[model samples]
Target: MRMKRYPFSNKALKAMIAATVAFTPIAAFGGGFHADQVEAAEQNLNFTDLESLVAYLQTVRKHLTDEDIQVLNEAQEKADRISAEDYVDRILKAPVSEEGRALFVATIDFITEVNLLEAKKEDIEAFAKEQSPNVEAVFESEGTSITMDQYLTYVANVEQKFLDIIQLTEIEDLSEEKHAIALTRALLSAKDPSENAVITKTILRNINQEEAPGAIKELVQKIDPNLSAAKVVVKALKKANEKPEEPTPPGNGGGGTPGPTPGDTTPTDDGVEVTPVVEANGNEVIGTIPDALIDEIVAVVTPEKDEVVINLPKVEVGQTVSLLIPAELIDKLKAKAPDADITVQGDGVSYEIEVEDVDTAALAKKLGVPVSELSLKVSVNPVPSARALEVTKAVQAKGAKVLSQIVDFSVEAVGGDKSVILRNVGNEYVKRGFGLNANVNTNRATGVRVNDDNTFSAVPTRFVTEDDKQKAVVKSLRSSVYTVIEGNVTFPDVDKGNNWAENYIESLASKYIISGKTNGKYGPDEYMTRAQFAVLLTRALGLPGADYDGRFKDVKGDEWFNVEGALMAAVKNGVVAGKKNGTFAPNDRITRAEATAMIGRALNLSFVDFDKEKFNKNKKITDFKDAKKVGASTREDVLRAYQAGIVAGTTKGNFEPTAFTKRDQMARILAEFLIKADLMSELK
Candidate 1:
């Protein structure tokens, strides 16, 4: 009789699994004498519920051996002797004895070993025919049996269930998918061609068609080098069957496979021979520097012949050096490097030459060789001076705002009475084309000036008046990248006209935090509000998010960056609290005492181990007689803020605790707070 086939659908398959799970047939066995009865019962065993039958099959799925599958197939090919009801009863009533469990486990191992699901249709048919009787006989001995249709249906059910599990799992979640795919691939490779060829084709096709990651593709290639899974599937489905295309060697194209002429040689423009950019190091292409390029030292310390030739030790890129070229060669070298740094070294011993930026193309043309073969190292920056050392020490003593030191600078010719070349004297280099407002005083004279376009033509003559000097200072200090006056910061607006908080404003800007408006105007007298203060505190501490849920009702519509978020974060982090109104009146101006209290909280939160007691206990508040007038609510924080040197009283002995903090005053406090709190690193 022809065997019946039961195809699976998603819905039907789910129903089958659900039905089968209810009937976990625990199997049991004992010696029986009626041999004919056993064979007869095996032939007629029935399945009452299709789902229960499927579930029973699943219980022993992992234990189903190649031999067991073969038995079921062969038995089905023969005949259906058992009734559906009888089959279900026998399976459900079967006690889960040790022997049955062991048999199930063994069958599962066999299926895994042979990759049973991947077996080709013809191979499966052949195995069923060959082992059908044996499969029937074994079940008969256990007093239960299944037809070939039932057995095939059960196998299909089990395979589909596993595949569904893999499919439903998160695609990116590879922990389980990786292991399952790997183990199946191993089994596929180990099984006979007839047993796994079909399944391999299916798996490979799925992997190729899905939006799989590279890792899955790699696994498929590992499974079969000759049989292309996707191509085989396509060929199999074609009406006019054609031969499946040959599989490319593993790692072809973008993978491990090498192209023609592996390790082919190529030459660079410099006459240095090297291999192609693609090298087979684990099948990855990596860039390589020629062996001759590393640690190359080019020496041009001494002149050669009348050409000013350089010796090739090694080529250092981007290094500018002071070259002691002869006066006759100076014009010739300058012509070659018209746009380079060939400034005179102090006292004119050597001309500072930028070797890296120098026209190497021009140099190469002159040398009659490729630029690669041209080797030279140039001094890039000047050596630090005593003035640089002094400036560094002074700034660091004030605060740790300096990021880097002055490495190079240019100066105009120094000769006239007011034409003094102020060499390197600040955090940044004093280069030609650089603008800096400087207040100069050397005991003999005192004046403020600007270095314009590498030249300072300001000359204080006998005819100059006091008002003229003041006007000259203001005009010269309109807008500069930097300014320094008598070891203090000098802002464009903080001149003789308005220098109340000049020291504090300069200190903050130097730390690289506070800044002037786009117009270069530092509004020193503007009132600072609570919302502004919160944002500032948050920035100084590098808090997590720039914005958060609206924790304060009154702080709505404030769309500025970190306006609401900063206030929320501060409150959440216990750095600040709302007033009794339960609203954060962020727009309201904050008083000196209130600002001091918030600053104190920020310090404590940031420092972690900040000594609140010690800060308030030794509070010598600059001999402020009005300190007692400070509100009790903010008295301790007031004293702590004063001692921290961030907040100072008016001219003498008067703590103006109730006074509103100006923008420039706030800047001073923040600068000092950052320094003392050790939070300058967070600015980066």
Candidate 2:
């Protein structure tokens, strides 16, 4: 008989089966067979689920002799003689009742069909390996002490109980209750069952009604009294009847007298007269307000303003004064000020604001250090018309001391649409290798944001040297507390002492501009292929490539470069061109000249003269000794790229245009291009 084809691919079907087997529990074997005796009799084939069984089979298949195969075949024939219903009845030690027989039979048929599918040995092995994590999760949830046989017994008992409940229920169509039960099952089986239990209970309490029907509720209580599916149905009904809250009247606070309006003048207890200034952009400015009167002004100011900017006298050095803006007022300051100037000013003293306390546990986890080893400080600066913020840490660490100082910089209205540049903030100890012992690679310092959930997320950061000082520059879009931490990415093969491109590689890797090989090595000296270079260039430019239509005959959709959309994006952006044969030799090694041409085109560097010959004749672009060796097609591109600081010649003043570009050389070129084009923020 021909096998029935599944809707999904063979690999997908195998994966689905693996996942189900990994999570499913088998029925316990009966007939006076002890667990140990059954295990020995089955030759360790008494697995809890199919995933473990398949894994064991694959492992032993490689070493199985002809005699062993014959023994296994004989055993399989005996197992096959038993019908699915009989096997279930024997393993479960209970016969399926009339009410649940149909469902049980349907499940058995599905399993039989899966067994009939032609799965190769390698396919089963791959599926086992892929689902190993899920299998481990199931065992972990069930507890390590519980053996496969014990788990099977427990599962069988649960199944029998569920079947009994089904036999007792008269309602044939309980679709709504079924959905609620499904949700409850998922929550109970989640990684954190206790936490999910609270969520389920809260949901039920808010939606449960005294007048709602109790039949489904009683059924659900029989399954799990702590969680009821009928509550969800009540929730749906209540939600459908819920009415929207009425909007508050303008200028009125719950039918009370209207509060202080914009432009209102209020006097503090200290007799410091404060006036609220409202701008055309809806920004409220309370100028010349003394620091002592901030609280009074905050209390009287209306919360409807876009943002409240309080101008005060210079804050004393080392004195931290928290802003007293009300929670409602802060909520109103949600509009992003992308174009607003944000700078650290006032000569060692600046306006300070209170932000959420740092999560030391999360920070320690991210930095891979003990909570006791970390210390954090938050600094707030509110400046007018400033586009950049520079918060300097002048404290120097002593010899051999772990410099785990985390400086948090906070700004308002810096939206994701625009990035704020922070300079000279976290590079004090980078040059001295202060964090080497603490697993902090100072050479690879990165920026991170403090998430609302008290977690840290990496932000794009780059390091640059200016005036003999190494500075860590970070760009962020959100107005929140941001800090610089030692980057966790490093390659065993790339060393800073000998490799000229180590900084470039580290910076790019930290920002996800490049990745290492499978062996955790950054093949810096290895030659780069055309497709590889194109992919790196696309990442450097941050281009979002469009859907490809097989523009290059030789580049297939399945190829990594095509799937990555590098070649397609390069072609779309006019940064690369195919050969005369109409094929992009993506796998071919890229020459320095070819790479230079691509970089020049990406930067949009062009001469006024359209003709290359005329442009070359008009300008002496380079003084390289081997300038003539450069191909005529790329000579102008090479010269233009050099002029734009995107590429450099050899030490001997020879442009090795025909040399195959190494991975290190490619990194340097891309880094230079990003810095020169101002695509990335660099400290001056």
Candidate 3:
């Protein structure tokens, strides 16, 4: 029997396909399949399918033989012969070629699309009933029989299968159009709109378009009119439709007709003549920016005392501007503009105030300063876009604190961007997003800094808050904020009693083993270097004496007094080994696994006994989710330390063994090790 092939109508296909993930092809008779062929095909076709499906489709796009199709069909028939309970399993287990994978995805997608159609319940029931006879007859031919209820269940679960396929496929290889279409369809068909909306938005934001185009717009329109999806679609479509074009191309171009001549002047409503700023190309004046389109932004910083005053560079309202000021300037700004809109950001906190109707003269008099002196510091202010404001809000949501010595604030237009960086530091593999829209360009940076916007560094285009990505950003930001921490518990900048490890830190500090930086701040979240870690360990262990004989090339003269003695002691005790280059990189941050191993060595030196057998038997360490990722050599040490209650994993079930230990973390671990090793009492 020739299998039935139901092709969608041409009109429906055209409306549905912006990019397609629908093809089931066997090994092509000839031609090599290009890796990029699938994505390019997505630009013209409709949406849907998984990896085997993607690979199969890629092969089909390359070539296929009639014999390959026959073999694929026969394999499918054989797989279908299994019981309904065994259907999914058998299909997954069966060995098939690239064509077979495409067929699998296509079959699942077809059934899912049919089930999700918005027809009447009665029509759906009737359609299912009508299709049952044929479905069952085909199963019967394969010596397998399925009840009507089982068939309906299979139809209902087809959505899940499609989801599975999508999860398995290398979405990076799929075009933005294809991903957008698939996600949009999934959003529309989802039974729970609220839950599905999140997934759809996440996918859309990755491929986030400044404006929805053509089929995407239509797809968005198909969703419920009252949903935010519809509103977003309409807005995107409007943006696309309303995008403005430059008056004319710039430079010395000998192109078509030139715009208004260089000396040409137009009269304003007030009878004032204005000449457009145009670039000269021989006699032709090209690239005109009209006077009406020019906008301005000005910022004024005034201090009560006439010590230091600043008037920033003037910029257009939509242009991005960064303000660099001394940390002491914050109080002056507050006095000048109290009740101003303030947002605490990295490196500094910023306050914005409108410059509409403020009396500069009176304000100067009130502050006991002359108008001339006040004017030296203050300038006109520009308003930030709603999108920029939104970004500020998101940044603040993750715990933003002002920097110590300097403060910087920046604001720019929403769409006038150059590029962004999306660095994934999570343990699990993450699929790359569609990235920024076509308008933005991305360039990698050697180093990133806050408040520096001239070259793209830390700007994020797609932010997935409430996920590992957000936490990673927070962790990284916290680590980067401090290079030095010097203070006691009462120090204002120390952020006293903020974390659960406060007690541990305070205990260590009380013993004079831990001290803050010269700035009177304890940077708890700062990374702990090898030298720093060694000093802390020796101090905690109360190892005596200083012996320096140039054992390691990196450990130099008397200037290294702080860690030199501790380093020599640690080396003698077999706690640390220098790098392969015969250099002890004392400044290098210590990883979590390395720290644990060091602690285990110390415990052994101190004669602390814990059951190794019990540690190996404990499911908490042995059955960790990411246990396999731990280095084979250090895995047993980590498990033993964890079980002995000297250390713990980062999250509930997974030990991020390779992650670097922070200063605060080192203190906490030291405290825990002391308690577990019965040394806490001796310290007191």
Candidate 4:
């Protein structure tokens, strides 16, 4: 367990993902709204309630930091000293009057201030379902003159504003477009219109345009009683979009408005496709938000003074400590902290503090701050860990927040990127909806490399497995290549074979110019030794001296088995001989590491290692997309090979790093390489 130095959890970060957990109670952890939306809401002066709230929030924003008091003092002093009306004009947008603009600025400043009040939400105000009269009065600038119709229009506009936000405050609805309006109206309007037409349309049809035809067809068949020939499908569509509370004719019902005709080509701007409501009658909701009226949000002017600073009596001077050190002295400083019982946190220049007895003056002097600035109550606003800070920045950049309280710091450490960071949504109910369509589970992917528009592709596309031994895969590739060299390989048709890869290779033997043994067996499991592969390479290429090279330490007179064919095929042709170390280890299994080295040597490619330690070279070939490789004679050679794409992983995508090389696999890899290198066409 980590120590909780401050009163907050060590991992209580502002950027943790909001993933849903089992046994977790229902809650909305991932609210779409970002700090900016709240800021935007604060900036809108057209709406009264929003304006008032904005004023308060602005104040909060101003003082959000601990250094704010000093910063404000300096900025305000500068502002006071200048007192330029033109500068004030630049900051305010009130119509026609400078004083009005100043008042507007004041309102902004006030709202910004209110946002800082830790006591916010403590007032606990609610209007329940009934429409709040004040909401209209403020929007219209009339305490009692606005009509209900006018008030609703204002509600729509407010809803629009919230919808425009990347995210909004936590609300029960948001499942559909109409719900946006309902959600907005509900927030301000007390009346839940049972007949509200808007609610019906959004709830049933707004979000299902792509699948509407099928949904409509099903609805039509279920309510078959109402569809006896000649009715316009539009009428059916209208019926299907209806709300449940509204009465329908001789109903056998589920809620639906009317459906569309066969010739309909597109979805409505409202995001719904017209479909026939075939149920004896689909359900209908009766609700309409009349247009042409304006929405009004009222503001209650609260007169209050925010922060006020005053001249203070001179603080008794404190001792001073300076923090300037040369790099050469850092080691000496670092060496003293452990023995001195002092806590120094930052890197280099050892900045720390340890006081057995601190008088006020000594404390002031030690901190290098004036006594006047010190407070008996040292309130350090909550700060998340550095890992969480990265997450906060990422989430904030995307206009989102981390509302889930979780101890898993990895999500934040991954930087709140949806691909890499897992979210703890704090509630199982809400976790169901996340990522693009909320269909893909993000937890499985290692990470995502995102595009500028926030689109992402999974990194290292496949999962790593223990079976991913690079050596084994390399062996298999060699074996496959050997099989390709010897043709007439009769094998089960791959289209029906249990092991498709093996069967496919056998079928392609002739296509690769592979002439198999007279026995008709491809020796599918045969290990393709390096020399055997030379024969295959020689057959494919016309190279100088493609015959014999008695130059190898192991390829001696009595020992050369297929050396006649292999030596001519490999040595004369320069396919391969051995490594820089002089020992070919030819009989030894060929690992991806070795394969990479071989390919590097074959390709004469250069491989550099800037940070070899960070990359796990042992990583098996998992990504099939990698095909280019640099053939070299070193261990790094394998990495270059994997990176270049000359090699790939097995069925599970792991080039087993420590496994043996096999003949069939080698032949297969080379054959596959032929296709990749564009040297040979894909086997027909």
Tens-place lDDT digits, model 1, residues 1-684: 622211111112111221121111011001000000000101112334323433433443444445555543433332122222212212221222332333333332223222222334454465456545544443343334544444444444344333322222232332322223322212222211222222222222222111222222232223322222222221222212224799877845575745434222222232122221222233122222232222111111122211122211111111123212222223333344332233222211111333322344544454565545443222213222233334333433443211121223322211112222223211111121111111122111111122332111111111112422211111111112111222233467875657666655654454333556677777788898887777666545434333556666676646563543656666666666677766778778988888988887766662233444535455575477886777777776666667766677788668777889889779768766765653322221
* Per-model tally of clashing residue pairs: 37, 3, 17, 140
Model 4 Cα lDDT, one tens digit per residue, 1-684: 632111000000000000000001001111111101111121122333433433343343442344544433443333233322332222212222332233223322222222222214332122111233432322232112433343333332332333222122222222222222222222222221323322221121112212322322232222221221102111222233334787656765777766522212122232112111111211211111111110100011011211111111111011111111111122222232211111111101111121111133433454455543322211001111222234333533432222211111111111111121112111110001001101111111112222233321111111112232100000010100000011133444222353435533653453333445556555556666655555455433322223334556665534453433544544532346576666555566556555445554444411111222433465543343333332233545555455556575668655555565665566566655444433343444
Give candidate 1's error at residue 323 in angstroms: 44
Candidate 1 has an lDDT of 0.36
RMSD of each: 30.9, 24.3, 22.5, 31.4
Q: Which stretches of candidate 4 lie over 4 Å from their true place?
A: 1-489, 492-498, 502-504, 515-518, 547-549, 557-565, 568-575, 579-586, 605-632, 650-654
Per-residue alpha-carbon lDDT of candidate 2 for residues 401-516, written as tens digits (9 for 90 to 100): 11122333442122223223322222110111001112233344555444443344444445545454344444443344444444345687785555777878876776556788
TM-score of 3: 0.27
- List, residue by residue over 498-550, the lDDT tens digit for candidate 3: 75566667556643456677787777788988877777776565444258668
Every model's TM-score:
0.29, 0.35, 0.27, 0.24
Model 3: residue 3 alpha-carbon error in angstroms: 99
User: Where does candidate 1 have its weakest 10-residue lDDT segment?
Assistant: 29-38
All candidates' lDDT scores? Answer: 0.36, 0.40, 0.36, 0.28
Give the TM-score ranking, best first.
2, 1, 3, 4
Error of 3 at 283 (Å): 99
Please tell me which predicted candidate would have the highest lDDT against the true structure: 2
Which of candidates 2 and 3 reaches a greater TM-score? Answer: 2
